[model samples]
Target: MECPNKEKNLNRCNCSYPSCSRKGLCCECLHYHLRNRQLPACCFPDDVEKTYDRSFEKFAELVMKGKI
Candidate 1:
């Protein structure tokens, strides 16, 4: 089934990974990341998102630093 909010979600998506099929699909993106033991790009700020360090550790660090 097509996601009705894909376009709207894309407007807010911060993923920097190119050629991502899940770019605008939050559910798929989240599931993919979780399966890899990582968080999706949208979980971090633009700067951090670009670093591609979507690990739970990274997210926790950012949270502790109040950067998220």
Candidate 2:
């Protein structure tokens, strides 16, 4: 399904995955990441996001460190 907010969402999406098809599709990206036991890159800061470590563990660690 075509995302109606694709353009708008892309403006705020921080996903740095070079060829991500869901870059501008928040719903699809969220579902795909959750299914894989991960969070979308948008959940992370750019520095952390670039590492591509979107796991729940990573998020928890960041939260504990007050980095999120």
Candidate 3:
């Protein structure tokens, strides 16, 4: 089934990974990243997201640094 809010979701999506199949699919994106021991790009700031370091450790470090 198609996501009802795909277009809207895309507007707020900060993922910079080109050709990502889960671009506008929030649930799938979250699941895929979590399964790989990482967080989705949208969880981080745009600059940070661009680094493609979505690991849980990175997110924690950002949080600790009050940058999230």
Candidate 4:
């Protein structure tokens, strides 16, 4: 989709998924994750993101624990 802000977004994206096609494309990444009932890795801490558990439940848990 040729995101104009891709390089800039990449600097802040913390996704650890090695082969993510939407790595720097925030819109695509968010839509993709939401369709799967998950949040993109950018919503999580690096430690948590690396676990590949981007579920809504996980995000809630982290929020409740003040970990997000």
Candidate 5:
């Protein structure tokens, strides 16, 4: 039950938002994000995620604008 992928990504991941409960465990990470109507950290690049705006609406806006 070890999430090696997520754990490993932690070292290089640019997700600096506070209150992130899924520092590891990709599955749980996705679940947590989606449950809140937002995309996971991995979906965005460093600069974008740095905005600390993890919302599904924002992600969709970026997608529609082809900025993501």
Candidate 6:
């Protein structure tokens, strides 16, 4: 199968994290996040993505603190 990233036209995603396994496939991306008890990259703003806290609990904390 063709890679989903083939259509992204991106040299790099703005996810900011260097170690994300969900770098391209949107379906796999969401699945990975759900399996890991975390939110996907789309939930975060630019600044928050820089922090690299992808956990659901951490995202909730950000909401509670009005950071995201």
lDDT digits (tens) for residues 1-68 of candidate 4: 59999999999999998899998999999999999999999999999999999999999999999997
The lDDT per prediction is: 0.93, 0.95, 0.97, 0.96, 0.77, 0.72
Candidate 2: worst-modelled 10 consecutive residues by lDDT = 16-25
What's the lDDT for residue 15 in model 3?
Answer: 98
Candidate 2 lDDT by residue in tens digits, 1-68: 79999999999999998899998999999999999999999899999999999999999999999998
User: lDDT, candidate 5, residue 6?
Assistant: 70
Please list the residue runs of candidate 6 whose C-alpha ends up more than 4 Å from where it truly belongs after superposition: 3-13, 19-21
TM-score for each candidate, following the candidate numbering = 0.93, 0.97, 0.96, 0.97, 0.72, 0.64
Q: Is candidate 4 or candidate 6 better by TM-score?
A: 4
Please identify model 5 stretches exceeding 4 Å from their true place: none
Worst 10 residues of 5 by lDDT: 6-15
lDDT of 1 by residue, 1-68 (tens): 98999999999999998999998999999999999999998888999999888999999998999998
Which regions in candidate 4 have their CA more than 4 angstroms from the true location?
A: none
Over 7-68, each residue of candidate 5 has an lDDT whose tens digit, in order, gives: 57687656676777677666887788888888877788677788877798888888998988
As a TM-score, model 1 comes out at: 0.93
RMSD of each predicted structure: 0.8, 0.6, 0.6, 0.6, 2.2, 3.0
Please give, for residues 1-68, the per-residue lDDT of candidate 6 as tens digits.
65667458234456666876556666777787789887777778767777867788888988899987
- For model 3, the stretches where C-alpha displacement exceeds 4 angstroms are none
* Residue 25 displacement (Å), model 5: 1.4
**Better TM-score candidate (1, 6):** 1
The lDDT-based order of candidates, best leading, equals: 3, 4, 2, 1, 5, 6
